[model samples]
Target: MNAPTGKELEQARSSAQENHRALHRRISRLSDDAIDLILRDARSHYAWKDQPIADSVLHELYDITINGPTSMNTLPARFVFVKTPEGKARLAKSLKPQNVPKMMGAPVTAIIAHDMDFWKELPFLFPHEDRRHLFDGNPEYCADTAYRNGTLQGAYFMIAARALGLDVGAMSGFSNAIVDEEFFAGTTLKSNFLCNIGYADETALFQKLPRFPFDKVCSFA
Candidate 1:
């Protein structure tokens, strides 16, 4: 597909803002199917059908996810889509025994990582002040910020994919060190987690797990 023109981009942004305002008015909620597709009925898939995710879908997923909010707009999340056989092989070296088959079978496995030097872009992302200096020599602060925002982005990614009719299986059962060495070598990026994406096999899914009620997990101030 052709890249969107400046006018098209502006139009899309305007449309999105209109939708955002509509949501706040309580005049409407998303259609049941749409809600199910993205949340209530979505499951953490472990098995996939023999279908492939298109490159365009991956691009669109990122486009949608990048719009999600980040702390100080420090969008530190980076993704490496492992779709090819060679790419999967490289990823397999870091997978745990229980996760190996799942990774090998999925159409794509995304290596969600965070850039340690993301604050360097604060001049453009946070522009109002010179925020980059805050992390210039503070390794601990930079690491904490990167991991925090990067994990949020990873969740955004999964939501975006589900909204686009894809299933997601997010896993943390792997070696971050091995993934960083294999995929992020020579870069300041460090692995956060892995997610398998594709069409899920409904028959292969386990029973739905229960969640805590709102009152049990929350408190009013």
Candidate 2:
């Protein structure tokens, strides 16, 4: 588990390039059914089955989530899995009234948050370049990078959960100030959104909503 040195790093990079070349030659793609499972068919669940999620599952979810890319590899997102009745009760105070029951029904609700001081880890995360000092004394840069990348990670969370046969209901209707005060006090972490994860109560699911067509939302340019 030692860190790769100069020669080792070069070899790794070459191996990666070779792998990418192989992939390009093959042009592997996800099956349409697999796509449906992760994005098309997946619905934002509102109710969950009584089954409980284990700590190991949460750990596995996080392990998959961090593998998704981030700005300068900052990896700003932090999570708080609220699963206990007491924790859920506390979290309920920060959510909109309508969302409280949805969160409660799910066995685990993840508080997806970002750290304003995440730049401190840049030196380690983005080791190829010394990016650690780039955000120093810059509130705007810190806030923007953390939020943008953290939100991307949040999206990855839902997709990864679906791939793992878990239902997800993500929302931003919570009071950020309240959640921060209650769950992230004395820390630099700021709440981005909440995602409830568990097996869905399919009978309680609503019809999937429509999305903007590719033509309407995109352009050839």
Candidate 3:
């Protein structure tokens, strides 16, 4: 990679400084209304335009995604990008009827998978202790770690897409076994979810769905 130019560094510094306060603020201090705005702004987009996501843009997306939280920074998530017609066709076989139409229409589908062998890399990730020892021979613990952290990483991928001004539709109505066997053959990585990504088709958006209020979902000591 080439060295960063003065102009690029300056731009990065300016952008960093502008969001410094918000970036450093604690999550607990954020009001429910503000949190709602952030969550609402990160909503999935159903329909998409005919444009294609460039390879360079995909790289940026991955770069941003790896920074999300994970248990002991295990970093178990692995992504499979379906941009070819053949790949999409294979993935389509696993999708439920309701998800097929929207997914098939999108430009790309990201298959988020979890690496069962992620513990092997825990030494590099959590160097303070040999956390790998916690997972060795403990199949149930390993499985739970992969599934939970993989799901969290998948959410980060969606937010990264949103941060980059791209629209996303994350769907869970799909077959995990079929997806795993077909796409991740011989690998420990297993499918978590499918996220369709592209520019939004605003005309196809349905009415906003209702959500439960805080009082019913929270309690104070």
Local distance difference test, per candidate? 0.92, 0.90, 0.86
Runs in model 3 lying further than 4 Å from the true structure: 1-38
Clashes of each: 0, 0, 0
TM-score per candidate, chains pooled: 0.88, 0.93, 0.83
- For model 1 the local lDDT of residue 153 reads 97
Q: Which digits, one per residue and each the tens of the lDDT, describe model 3 over residues 133-175?
A: 7899998999999999999999888877877778889999999
Candidate 2 local Cα displacement, residue 55, angstroms: 1.6
Model 2 regions more than 4 Å off: 1-6, 21-27
Which scores greater on TM-score, model 1 or model 2? 2
Tens-place lDDT per residue, model 1, 146-211, is: 999999999999999999989999999999999999988999999999999999888888789999
Per-residue CA lDDT of candidate 2, range 25-88, in tens? 8877888988999998888889889999888988999999999999789899999999999999
Candidate 1 overall lDDT versus native: 0.92
RMSD of 2: 2.2
